[model samples]
Target: MANALPLVALLVLAGSAALASATTFTVGDSQGWTTGVNYNSWASSKSFAVGDTLVFNYETKAHTVTEVTKSGYDTCSEANKLSDDDSGSTTVTLATPGTHYFICNIPGHCSSGMKFAITVSATRSGGTGTSAGAPRVPAMASVVVAAAAGAAFIKLALL
Candidate 1:
């Protein structure tokens, strides 16, 4: 029992770290998804990855978060929406790699620059240790290696 404690702890820690994400971007930052703010510029300042999340925070239902195709995004058309959310807050997970487009389907909103596009890499950034099988962060890999070594030592001592 006592001999197994450290191994258990190591497993738990690794599990927790694996479940973490690279980033959770609050769209538009403090400006909170709204008009007059440059959402594309906002997106440009950050790196997006698979398994990361995007939170759209707005003050009212006057705006929407609409996921659409490149054509829809280009034309600001809402006829073929992949997903649409009118809630003041919308959460979207970047599940796959490639370019993703979002726009406000409300009339005049998207054309007014209330839209943004992001390219999600197939990787998690900044050593997030996400479950997406993102490249192992060197430091985290070291910790995991050390932990494994420690557990092995403990097992040997028990013998």
Candidate 2:
């Protein structure tokens, strides 16, 4: 009975910790290219989880979170998407765990310092040393990464 109690308590604590670590972040804040935008520092900012999905909500001006490769840094690359001018949404799921580079494919955007980056960490397994896969965490943490600088919400999840 004593051993069982300790085991149960540990399980409960682990579950709670996982829930707390789960986070969500908006892709685009309520601002234009000037200030108060999410993309401004997204490159060295945003975060990701194993099964997290990045929700790109386009509010104004056509934008996209296209995947790119950091010249010298070797990490995960390739996954990307372009925002739809009409509905304005581009969702991409983080299947593997690694760092992903993203930037606006728009002309003058990337050059004008309109670059974004995100780090996707391994998902929290369900006790068996594997990710719990909780529908993707909104994001892992907030770093120097800037926002999209448009009218949109780039949500990162941890699944």
Candidate 3:
């Protein structure tokens, strides 16, 4: 029974680390997904990870977010698009590690520099992931672990 306390602590720490791995990023920052701004520069300034999310905020009537292939992105082609969203607020999760491309499908939007490509890394440990804020689960887990440790200590004292 005494040996279980150390094992529990280890498990709690592992869980805390895993919960901190995911991150969310607001795409384009304050300017958001829109025209007249340099999307390329916005993308270049940030690092993306596989588990991170990209949130695109824009005016739905004036713009549409389209996920496209490399070829489609290059030619600003809307044909054979992978996905399209005009919700004004689109949340895209980077599920895999690869080069993902997005563009505004509104006529000349893509040609006018409304396109950006982000390369997501496979692992978050390469200093390529953005931390939106502190991981909530880690803090909660730490508190729970501390309580458990206290209980364990009390039980040992009683024994």
Candidate 4:
């Protein structure tokens, strides 16, 4: 019985840690923007963590989730790339644990509030943590709302 006590305690602790660390965030198109949600703009609760995947749902207008850094923080900007807008949606896996700056590269959209921020937390769990977040992901039954009609697709050269 004495040996079993210690083993049981270890198992309990491991389970608690897993419960606390597992999480996922489902990001979708913005509603306010006539151009639709340009970048990492979700419904609300603008925050996220590592091991989480940002699901960019499609709309009639094509948009991209372009990772970037602030004007003075150029280091992060170096490794950033633009995800192609196919299937009207896609998912970008958050690999590193840090503040990810993103914006819509669609013409003047970024300047028009088509930008947002996501914080990726670094919890020790097989590199990529489980997808978890508040306001949980939406059900599959709902249709994605696209940008207002006549919003032309803007093309820009990525950095």
Q: Write the per-residue lDDT of candidate 2 for residues 64-129, one digit (tens) a residue.
A: 556666741122223333222223565666667777665555555556555556677786443221
User: Whole-model Cα lDDT per candidate?
Assistant: 0.80, 0.47, 0.81, 0.49
* Between candidates 2 and 3, the TM-score winner: 3
Per-residue alpha-carbon lDDT of candidate 1 for residues 12-88, written as tens digits (9 for 90 to 100): 67765654545677888778889999989888877788877888988667999999999999999978889999989
- Model 2 TM-score is 0.46
Candidate 1, residue 99: the lDDT equals: 97
User: In candidate 1, which residue ranges exceed 4 Å CA deviation?
Assistant: 1-11, 125-159
- For model 3 the local lDDT of residue 35 reads 87
Using TM-score as the measure, the top candidate is 3
Query: Over 4 Å off in model 2, which ranges?
Result: 1-24, 31-47, 59-61, 72-87, 124-159
Q: List candidate 4 stretches off by more than 4 Å.
A: 1-21, 28-47, 72-87, 124-159
Candidate numbers sorted by lDDT from highest down: 3, 1, 4, 2
2 versus 4: better TM-score goes to:
4
In candidate 4, position 1 carries an lDDT of 33
Q: State how far residue 149 of model 4 sits from its true place (Å).
A: 55
Error of 2 at 146 (Å): 44
Give the clash count for each candidate.
Answer: 0, 40, 0, 11
Each model's RMSD to truth, in Å? 7.2, 15.7, 4.4, 18.4
